[model samples]
Target: MALRPNPTLRQRRVGTELRRMREQAGLGGNQLARELGIHAAQVTQMETGKSGISVERLRTIAAACLCGNQPLIDALADMVSERGKGWWEKYRGTLSTDFLEIAELEANAHSISTWATTYVPGLQQTEDYAAAMFSRFTPSPPSHDLDARTSFRMQRKEAVRHGKTPYASFIHEAALRMQFGGPRVLADQLNHLVDDSLAGRISVRVVPFDLDTFPGGGENIMFIEGPVPELATLQMDTAMGSMYFDAQPSLTRHRDVFARLNSVALSEPESREFIRSIEYEMRGKYA
Candidate 1:
């Protein structure tokens, strides 16, 4: 069968995990090919996501690589079993690949934890708030592009809501207070946040400005937990673009960062009260 010219991020991730297993077993690509009775080039193709692997083939490779982690093995096999294109595929050519990747990651995530210092987490932003923020792009996007992005974001939010993924968001006070569209927009956005939190659909915690000795220096982090811990992905949003990290050490570091943030941030109930207070404050000011 012909190979895909550009595989989705999820497809590439399966290939990456296979490569890691091969390396951990101390077997080179040629050795792996020989063990599986395949050409070295074929092995490379599989590892680069240029080709697909069947569940049986994946099992054979995992066994040969001496990978004993049943959960990890099962996860890889499941990836191989996935069929058809996801909703994000429709925007393949229209949107940035990174944006589509984010949607795919969220769709497959077992749980999601985010840390936002400047802006409300994308999944939690209201339509008007998001539209206003997107309008600030340098050189500005064409109207259609802006509409597409905002529509895509709303779809992402719906996916998150219906997926029932456990979502924990650690937001700094500065972000909650930022009036991207104005006091009215911020008020509505905060009220929507309160409703989501009250309904037990999402967890929202706030890091107040009054706290001393805060770490992390205004970083935006989104940690996506896969079926297995080993398959977890960490995404850092920056001005340039989104950066993903999956190395054990990198995952460990971000986990620790989140833990520390959790420790200092307001508890869930307290966070709810805090948001309500802010919403009240905003309404009064705007009124």
Candidate 2:
């Protein structure tokens, strides 16, 4: 196949994993190229995700790198064989690459866990709530694009809903009370959460503002559990844009942080009641 000028996040990640294995084996790209009877530049292209590698070639490279982990090897093989377009591909030019990449990651994840300090997790947000939040983006997005953004988010929720992907959200109480859109919209959103939690596809937990302390400085996180532990991914948003981490150490730290946050959050039933109280308060105020 011809080389790709722009690779998707998943493609880049597959190449990155291969590079890691090669580095661990203490073999240079040039040396591996010699072993595989491919030009040195071709190896660089594969490592950078500019060129696609066949499933057979991926296995050969893994063996050459002295990697013995079957699961990891199988995962990479799957990446090599992944073909065709995903639903997110339709929005490639219409939306930012970051948005498309996020949807792709969530779609492929085995399960997802999130920690939200100021906003409801995207996969659980109602349409009006999301539109309100997006409208407040720094400098504000063009008014014409607001509908597209909201629809994209609503589609993202399907990632968890369809697969029964075991989504767990740890949201701070402040997020529940932020009143995005308005009191009525926020109330609707809170009520929606209660309904979702009852449906058993999602689990919601709240960390009350009264907590003396919180984990990770209440930073936002979206940890995507892959088919295997070694393939887990952590996504963090920054002032500039979203950053993704798949390295072992980064994944380990995020997993630990999520665990601590989960420990301090309210139980499912308790969280439902907490959200219900907030909904009642909002209804009284908004009515």
Candidate 3:
């Protein structure tokens, strides 16, 4: 069978670690290829997630790259053997590359933390809210494309709902009150959030608008905690595309930001009450 056109997040993450190791080893693609006794193109394919590497070969490459830690080597070997399909795979070719990548990362995350100042996080959005947001995209997407986006988004929500792992989200009060799809959609979304929050699949905390001091006040970010040896963080800038970071310092900075934001957000019960207030206000108009 022909190889799949799209790569899963785990594969891409593995590829990223390999590329980083090669760079850190002061070896270029050609040099690494020489060390591995493989063609440079083959090395490039593996590093770009277009192809897989065998465990034995991966170990050999790690040794060549001076990655001697046994745990790190073992992790790389495991990554090489990962062949499970991620939920994002079904949406391949339908959504934009950036969006698809985000979905994959979200699916693979051991834990997720998001700071949203203008809109609810994708994983927490209800179907109607998602549709309204999609409808606002510039030039507007075709009906079919919009439907595909909605379906893809709903699938993403399902991953969080059913996964063994959990997700944590910090939403600015502005996002909760943004009214993306008018009162009706906003009401439903808020109610859905309340349900999800109470269910324990997601942790929803609201940052009151009056808070004068807050981390990530000016930026919206999604931080995903990847498995070890491939430890990484992916940041999405609304205007600027997505950027992937694996450097320890950078990941620490984001983690710190999330911690600070979490510290300032309302407690779980308080957040539910805050959301309930918004829903009640919306009901007055839409109910």
lDDT of 1 by residue, 1-287 (tens): 79989987888998999999999999999999999999999988899898999999999999999999999999999999998888988988899988999999999999999999999999999999999889887988999999999999999999998787999999999999999988999999999988888888898999999988465656778999999999999998888888898999999888888889888999989998999899999999868
TM-score winner between candidates 1 and 3: 1
Candidate 2 pairs with clashing backbones = none
For residue 242, model 3's alpha carbon misses the true position, in angstroms, by: 4.4
Worst 10 residues of 3 by lDDT: 1-10
lDDT: which is higher, 1 or 2? Answer: 1
Per-residue lDDT for 104-147 in model 2, tens only? Answer: 89988888999888888888999899999999888888876888
Prediction 1 TM-score vs. true: 0.96
Q: What is the model-wide C-alpha lDDT for candidate 3? A: 0.82
Model 1: how far is 227 from its true place, Å?
A: 1.0
Q: Which stretches of candidate 1 lie over 4 Å from their true place?
A: 215-217
Deviating ranges (above 4 Å) for candidate 2: none
Q: CA lDDT of 56 in candidate 1?
A: 97
Number of clashing pairs per prediction, in order: 0, 0, 0
lDDT tens digits, residue span 99-202, model 3: 77887777667788888888898888999999999898788999999999888888888877888766888988989998898999999999998998899878
